[model samples]
Target: MIRFETAGESHGEALIALISGLPAGIPVDFEFVNRELWRRQQGYGRGGRMKIETDKVHILSGVRHGKTIGSPIAIQIPNRDWKNWEEKLPVEAGDPAKHQAVASPRPGHADLPGALKYNFKDARYVLERASARESTSRVAAGAFAKLLLRALGIEVASHVIRVGHVELERAATWDEIVAVTEKQDVLLSCVDAETEARMKEEVEEVARTGDTVGGVFEVVVHNLPPGVGTYANWDERLDGLLAWAVMSLQAVKGVEIGRGVTAAESFGSQVHDAIHYGPETAEKPTRFTRHQNNAGGIEGGISNGEDIVVRGYLKPISTLRRPLESVRFDTREATAASYERSDLCVVPAAGVAAEAMVAFIIAQQVLEKFGGDSLDELKRNYDGYIQQIRNF
Candidate 1:
């Protein structure tokens, strides 16, 4: 079984990840992993933390000279801001006077509940790890997952779809997305120029008022062969796995596959993708086809030889300079919620994180479908599955 876990606090020396169950002999690209980490720290409305940390992955184990040996892969991303925090958050016992304390819970953050659950008198402990800074490590682990998927000809990418009140009307093309995303330099990382400009303006407005905003992003997986997910088992549904991962991201409230909630309002005819088949081509062994794709490339919990599209809806950041009215858990006195250094909007960055999660889940699903102790064995199994389908 493929599994992964992360460790370390937000202000600690670094974050760590352990990913297991990948087949051996897959090439590992350090630069690609680093690039993903770099992409996660970007966006027009990022806060001081982004300016403080330049993410880079340190691969300590699980590969030999950049190829997987099949052992659990481990990665570490050092907290650049740890220099300033070392004294306050020292690993050893101290008077606790030097540490950053969070007495007030941010309105939308996990602060209050987490504190209550863990019996923490203050929320500082909870927010330190709960902070989106933790996603940096997940993105690192996902970078490796993407590398493995790419080896099998699977490709994943994401872009901002909507920012606050502004939404882009058209879907971006592969070439258009690749041309710019390969560089990963733009702040909004949006394909529509005007929409991106408007998003930046909105961020400026939010920042001016010390408020936060939210938006939506879509992650797409292309060039995936059919039968990579299972319909026989509910647990093996790829969409379920992908949704869980996306929803785990901070501020993400809803996840959609293909048409999503819109399907509920539509008649069956409008919601379902009809099929037609014929005219076999070199690229298509079972006759080139696809009358519609409203199902979003999946049927009965398995891929249908079409691209997978999943969009995530993110709510505004919880931390606000202009605090909301609330009472302290201990005193029960009316007061403004505590404010923390935060972003005005992070949908662009969230897009990158969503892609990481999508890629990781898809890669895991692929592994589950085609098992092997080695990359060559994995490829053999995959080829056999395809041949069986073609001959059927």
Candidate 2:
């Protein structure tokens, strides 16, 4: 099975991503991978960390002459900020005086629970791993997954739908969503300029009040074939897997598939899409069509030949500037929560991370369904499946 794992702390020497089970002959695009990393650092309300780091992937193995060789892939992204923290966070035992302890835990952060579980006196270690900076490695790895999906004529993109009380007035079209990625500067990543401006105002207000804001983002997977997932087993359900993947992101409190949240309040007729049949075309390999996509391109745990839409409801960044009420980790005395250098908002960045996760999950499903040791073999298998669906 195709899988990936990430290592290294937020302020460590570097972040590492190890991906395995990729077919041979898949081209490696360094620029595209680095661009994914760069996209993760954009958006309003980002903190000083983005300024200190310029993320670029360094391939260590499993690729030669710009192509995969049917082996494990190892990727590394050096942390420029590590230079300043090298002495404070050395691997070997160093001077105790150099240790910077998080005397008090930040509210809503992993500091308290992580320390309690690991028997740590300081929450610094927890802070290092729990930070959203870890998502950089995920984005890098997801970029590779995107490359695989792209070769199969599938594309993934995301956009901000809401920021605080300001939300997109209408559903974003596929072209509009894809256009957001081509812009030179990304402001909140909303498709509508007027709505994004409102989001900016909300962020500005929060920054002035020393508070943070959160919002929702939608990830759209286009040109995905039907039957990528199976309903034979509960764990193999596509919707459940997609929900779990998106919910795994830091600060994301909820996951919604299509109109799932609102569907609970609506009638069945209003929630379900009507089906129709049309002649098979190059763009749509299958003859089946839907009047609407309220099902989010998924029904009964499998893709249903429409764009898959997933929304992530992200909470505000946990580390605050003004801080909140809390107690010292060692002493029980009540005090203000510890303050840290953090963002005022990160919904746009979170959307980018979610896109990567969705891409990885879909790629995983694709590989499981169309097994091959080489790119050509995989395409042949995939093409056969497409023909089978078209003839159905």
Candidate 3:
């Protein structure tokens, strides 16, 4: 199975990620991975961290001369901010009284529970790893997965669906969606011109008021092959994996597949996709296609050669400037929670993270369906599956 792990702290020397189980011979792109990392730090209302750091990836190993060698890949992204924090978070233990800083507990964050569970008096332990800064490694690893999927003609993209109280003016079409996303500047990543403008206004409003606002974002994957996942086993379900991935985003409160909540209120006729077949043609004939994509490119836990649509709802950043009222961990005295520099709105950034996670899930599913020790073997297996589907 294809899997990955990332280790490091928010303000440590560097963040490291290890990804394995990729078939050999798959060519990887370093520039694309670095670009994705850079995208994650963008959007309006981002805190001072973005100004301090320009994220760039260093590929340690796993491939030679641009192609995968069928081994685990390792990547590192240094924290430029670490220079200042070296004494605070030293490689070796430092003076506790002078350097150690504790927070009573921040409302709407992992601070309290994590500190209590780990027996840490300080909330720093919770915020360090819990910070969305960790998504940097994910972006690095997931961008590689996206390259693999792209080689197989699968494409994934995401956009902000909401920001603060403003929803999008309308859902975007495939071509229009690509055009908007291709723009170099990604303020909010919202496709709707009018709504994104309104959202940006709201973000500015919130920042001036020292408040934060949360919103939602959506991702879509197109041109996926059918039968990549299985319905036979509950654990083999593709939708479950996608949901798990989307929900794993930091501050993500919910996930939606296809029509999602809309399906609950509608009749079966409206929810189910209608399939059609036609005569075989020389160019693209006999290949079954769908009139609708209500299942989000999945049926019975497997891909159905359609577009996969996933959505995520991100909560407000927990480390608010206007902190919430809470009791101090040591004295039990009522006071405001510790303050931290945080984004006023992160829907656009969350969309970036969502895209990475979605790509990772799809990569894992593809590897499971077509097991190969090398990329050439994997490609052969994939071609065979396509031929088999055409024959069917």
Q: Best TM-score goes to which candidate?
A: 2
Q: List the residue pairs that clash in candidate 2.
A: none
Model 3 alpha-carbon drift over 4 Å, by segment: 279-286
Worst 10 residues of 3 by lDDT: 278-287
Arranged by lDDT with the best first, the candidates are 2, 3, 1
lDDT digits (tens) for residues 142-244 of candidate 1: 8888988888778898888888888888877766666556764667878888888888888888888878899999888887877767788887787787889
Give lDDT per model, in order.
0.84, 0.93, 0.84
For each candidate, what TM-score against the reference? 0.96, 0.99, 0.96
Instruction: Tell me how far the alpha carbon of residue 197 in candidate 2 is from the true structure, in angstroms, after superposition.
Output: 0.4
How much lDDT does candidate 1 score? 0.84
- Name the candidate that leads on lDDT: 2
Better candidate number, 2 or 3, judged by TM-score: 2
Q: What would the per-residue lDDT of candidate 2 be over residues 1-392, giving only the tens digit for each residue?
A: 78999999998999999999999999989988899999999999999989999999999999999999989999999999998898999999988899888889988899999999999997999999998888998999899999999999999999999999999989999999999987779889999999999999999999999999999999999999999898999999999999999999999999999999999999998999988998768898898899899999999999998999999999988888888998887787898888878898999899999999999999999999999999899999999999998888
Off by over 4 Å in 1: 282-288
What total of clashing residue pairs does each candidate reach? 0, 0, 3
In the order shown, the candidates' Cα RMSDs to the true structure are 1.6, 0.8, 1.7
